[model samples]
Target: MSQTTLRRKFAAGLTALATAAGLVVGAPALVGAQATEQGSSASLGSAGSAGSAGSGDAPNTAPAFQPAAGNENPVGFRNWLRPGCSWDPVASWVQLCDVWSPAMNRHIKVQVQPARFGGNAGLYLLDGLRARDDWNAWTRDAQAQRIFLQDNITLVMPVGGQVSFYTDWDRPINLGGNLVEYKYETFLTAELPGYLQQHFGVRTDNNAIAGLSMGGSAAATLAARHRDQFKQVSVFSGYMNPTAPGMYTMIPLAMFDQCKCDPFAMWGLPGSPRWGQNDPLLNADKLRDIPMYITAGSAIPGRYDQPSSLQAVFNTFNGIILEGLSRGSTIAFQNTLNARPNQATFDYRTTGIHGWGYWNDDLIAARSAQILPVMNAQAW
Candidate 1:
């Protein structure tokens, strides 16, 4: 089918699905509007508990821990080492000491699944908007530990940042009646990398970043902003163009409804220069040299999903609306990128929703299709 015809059909399909799924409470408005009341907060709940087992049910294979001899530093001394290392028996990877971020003024946990061959190249996995404080969603919900067990690359997953967007916020947002200091861009791009390079043997030149939802946006923005550091990026169901027409308001409303956080504190008031600067579409030129893989579902429920309860049904409906928005935003971003000399591997799926099942699949697809090839080349 022609591109125009395909797009029209996709729109019609989405509208029909939304209406049937009980998403159309009133006259069909913008998907963003329907999404505001339901919001993406559905992700904050226990929707992933059913799928937390992940695709691989393999048992942990990490050997019993033994203390390193003589307190010898892995990559020599570092100043960011405020809170030191520990052993996590559950995942079987050495929990590298959670570092204190001067920017965020909090201790952020960083987990490392050490490369089998002691390879230095790192794959940074970023979490979504409703990031948990205990463990990254990749490990908890997606079983990433089992998936990359044999790979010769360090798996880096940072903990916390519920709605921070993994960016350097202009100011803190009051959420749950608490002010969250969200200098995540500085922590991840600057502070965390330096600490990882010194301690975990992660190399700046060979790292790839990927994220789901909020983290997906962060993966694109961070890679584009620091091309020298990240060589490849993958975004799964992320809103790539934050400065797009409805996004200016839709984003903040979602943030507030989901976490009581204010997006105004994230960048600035809508139409601020920071929004354009941080927008992946507006800064697509900076990502021209980097390999990127982007994917978003058409919001159709897939095989891996079954709504068993009323809450599950509501969650599924909300997910469909959210994924629809992501699909539209990703298409716009991809179209803009295609116009330039640079192009990303875009997987616009015919069926799926915004949840762990699709994000997990996208992660594996990105690894096989884009990340592993580059990392393998670099290894050779």
Candidate 2:
């Protein structure tokens, strides 16, 4: 087929995939709306709970932690959307708030679904490798707003952290002649937390973090480094042992493929200590006593697989290989943690791949088994 025809076909396939998965909800939901402080009775399903003995069964009902009546949001915090800060409503109980990231020299968007009733507990959801600037995958693809609509924990989903691994890079990364600033570690751990606490009423220290794919490793690393900031952490298909044998070259190549960005700009060079420093496996010791939930699939086709079209087939193939690698690193990290009193939960699926569906499952499983229980946010 001609190149133009191929491009059109690929676009069509993407549209179909997005439509079938209901990823088009963000554009309409970005408008301003009002959210009532009420409790949610939403319950999780058993699908993500399948695998290990402690994978955590779905609770019969959501948590019942209510915030102080007049302290949900600061006075005049919901007046408008932009101009600095405000509670911009998205859905029944969701709001989009933007905060200034001094390091990045711009405003960063945070999609929030406040807990039913209100609570100081917050859950930060990180996005994958190709995270977009408009919205987070947790809310866009995984439908996190719907999933946690009734839960009593503020959902903090920060948008746009494409290939930086959500880390504080040594320097600015040049992506195809465009320099992109990545001070994510500082932004997430310090800047964002302060904003959430001051405006959203979420406690800076009372939080949990979860992520899929690339973001997964970031979640682990951040939680390990900033243990006081996070009570629990869950990694879905993350490459914990990033400094493992072939990864030195694999990461840079993947970065190049994604945006022609120089990986050296992230950590200096291959043998830089930052590489090992950022490796979740190397820093697993710091995660001790922190409620940990880690998961990776077998890479085989599973329920969410749809290899019907050319784009779908290509995606499935890529996902299988990626998940296979993630499984190896996940197992290695699990091994490092297993040497002690097993405080971590590992959910190794017999059949699955690296995709949003399985990551969504991992999120629900982590919440039920580890996150909520550890944060005292579950009603089980």
Model 2 agreement with the true structure over 1-380: per-residue lDDT tens digits: 34344334433433333343333422221111121111001001112111122212211112222222343333333333433544544453456767799998878888876665557889999887766666675764565665555556778888777677889888888865877788999999889988877766789889999988788899999998998899999988888988987677567655544454666788878989999999998997888688889898886768777555433444454455567778878888988987777578888999886666677777777877987778876422
Error of 2 at 305 (Å): 0.9
lDDT of each candidate versus the true structure: 0.69, 0.67
Which lDDT tens digits does candidate 1 get at residues 165-246? 7888888778778776888888888888888777767886779999988888889999988887898899988888888766
Candidate 1 runs further than 4 Å off: 1-83, 92-96, 377-380
Error of 2 at 55 (Å): 32
RMSD of each: 8.9, 11.9
Candidate 1: global Cα-lDDT? 0.69
Local distance difference test, candidate 2: 0.67
Pairs with steric clashes in candidate 1: none
